[model samples]
Target: MTGLRYVYAVCRPFDAPLQAQLTGVADDPPRLLPHGDLVAVVSHVPEADFSEEALRAHLENLDWLTATARAHQQVVDALTVVTTPLPLRLATVFRDDSGVRQMLEEREAAFRRTLDRLNGRVEWGVKVFVETERTEQAGSEPAQPAPKPASGRDYLRQRRRQSRTNEDLWSRAEEFASGLHTALAGRADDARLHAPQNPRLSGAAGRNVLNAAYLVSRDTSEEFVEMVDRTKDDAPGIRVELTGPWAAYSFAGDETGRGEADEERHGESGGESGEEKTGEES
Candidate 1:
């Protein structure tokens, strides 16, 4: 009750309850802080850890950042299950409940609009990866290495073939991903494209071609999932992934309410693709 408020999301009143033992960032239980008809889902965290200065330092520590992001995500995920929440960016903190209330009052109109737009809808994430070399392989066997070049001319010829093959595979991957995105977008209320994740960071195999989030209605979720399933085997060496029924994280934005300083500080948190601010800090 005494520490800085780590806000996870904003929502309209709902009868559904959060888990009895739900622990949010800083291992504190989240409580609803209502202002007017809106509610701010928040948890108290130590100022020593959540202060702007402390956060700037902690953001540099991957282990700390990961833990925090995971905790923040837990609260947002929980909210998704009970109501349509307009998630705040990761690590959003305010000095006190008063500050949180001020934010709510300032953003009330935008919040209401976004929440209405997102009600009865959820977010779906899809990613496509292409392992170019895998396309050249036959079955599960490793590709046989080319015989040692008999001459410089032979080596050059082999190089050309390899180059052409690589080009063709990449081209096909691009085409397939583009086509798939178009199809999914058609079925979604809204769509957002994100930068391909770094392999080192995501630890995902193959080269990423598409990273997208779609806003989908709950009623048609099964059909949307089926559409994604049907594309799993559509391309030989491409990998497709789907994740969702998530809170409409991608579409939650209140540009009019976001001050320049806040925008500079939080940038694009809590919206679209659920990207974390783990890379660089402003």
Candidate 2:
């Protein structure tokens, strides 16, 4: 098949081996694209599948997008075992090695700065959710109002009670989410808050009150985790889950150098011409 280079990440040159049995798009094993003192983790893909034209179509296809994201993440995860990888966006393709080298040349200084900040660091994702459903053993006592109110007075009373209850629930949720994030961020090198996820979108059983990412050095990972655990008892009805030790996806800056996920191609010859990236979708 014709060659199209798919880049997973950029890192300082290392002597260790990449994770064995790892493959990226098209089931092709990723290889290194080293320029100067830096190395790029890359793999080959079919020209038609990864080209600019094809990407526009493939990105809109859910099945194709899912497969590509999984493959891309697999490669980045493997690299983390040996080095701190600054992850690129999914479907970041170039014509060949020359393009990859050009990216390194243009972004070399910025890459070094980010690497220095992230050298021994890995990203941790913390999601705080509030349980909306009562436990199974609550004995099924009226999920909602059992019967219509007998009078307007009763209806007004019920409505007043509900409004107060809702106000309390949301007030507590806001405080709980804020406190949890503050505690975690205290122990991390840096932290960022992402948009709160919807229940249907996250497929989580409860409302996602807090969605944040923390950049913690590898040596302090356990300390950060332990801190997260301690915060749980302080906030009872809230469910706190910790994920990762992952590559620094959320912390990595995107195009325009603003550190966000811009969904367009953004590379050129100028010093500011940069790569665009976002945190993991999987």
Candidate 3:
């Protein structure tokens, strides 16, 4: 038999049935690749050849990645909706069922403990974007004739002024984001700051000020959304986009051999929420 690759996550057994009902990456039936008390949730990769080039190609295509991720997320969310699921990172793969079982056996205790901590909770993603303040006044500004530069000193002064303006804008943006983070922290179980989005892709003159994620209990989702909505209203200059109730993707770090150790030490903090906000680079 040709072996298939799989992605493993530590979740409650009750979630398996719900996860099966949800759609997954491929049309192939999803299965619970189980080992003892732990289960390795899996979907088969039907590709005949699992070469490095094939993996690279799949990873490079954003569309493929997003679709697969969304599909995988659907299944994961179904599980998370019922259980505290520790989501695996995108493109995590195992050579076969045996590999998954061996991993589960090796890290069984850690996985169980992680699941215990995450039970009855879900992840939420939030992003803040600041639209550039219009420097030019609207409807009244008239075009002025360019003034002739008398000396190189004048040109240098112009460059310096522009640079200073840019720096100040960025500094203000950071301060605003920091305040937002501080405010949201009170309402979240854990929080994380992600790198800001690029201005070009964000299409906002100001900047992508904040990228963040929060983990909250299922019962607290409403309160969390309310907090984010309030933050948006308070900060008119910045637009906040929220997404998810997704699996804890950003929180799940490298899970190779150290899977057990990692989970045991996986201290929860503020993490970037799983919001699918698009920027220059994902």
Quick one: best TM-score, which candidate? Answer: 1
* Model 1, residue 252: C-alpha shift (Å): 1.6
| Runs of candidate 1 exceeding 4 Å displacement | 138-145, 254-282
Per-residue C-alpha lDDT of model 3 across residues 37-121, encoded as one tens digit per residue: 7777777665542234455565555566556656665666666666666766544556677767776788788887777766666
Angstrom error at residue 5, model 3: 3.5
Error of 2 at 224 (Å): 0.5
Q: Could you give candidate 1's per-residue lDDT for residues 1-282 as a string of tens digits? A: 688888888999989999889999899999999999999999988989977777767766756766787787788789888888888877778888888899899889988888889888998888888887686773667778899999999999999998888778778889999999999999999998877756764567888888888999988989999999999987778889888777765577632122221222222232222233321122
Query: Candidate 2, residues 23-109: lDDT per residue as tens digits?
Result: 887999999989999998888888777766666666666567656767777888888889998887667777778888998899899
Q: Rank the candidates by lDDT, best first.
A: 1, 2, 3
lDDT of each: 0.78, 0.72, 0.59
Superposed by TM-score, candidate 3 places the C-alpha of residue 173 at a distance from the truth, in angstroms, of 3.9
- Model 1: lDDT to the true structure: 0.78
Clashes of each: 1, 0, 11
Better of 1 and 3 by lDDT: 1
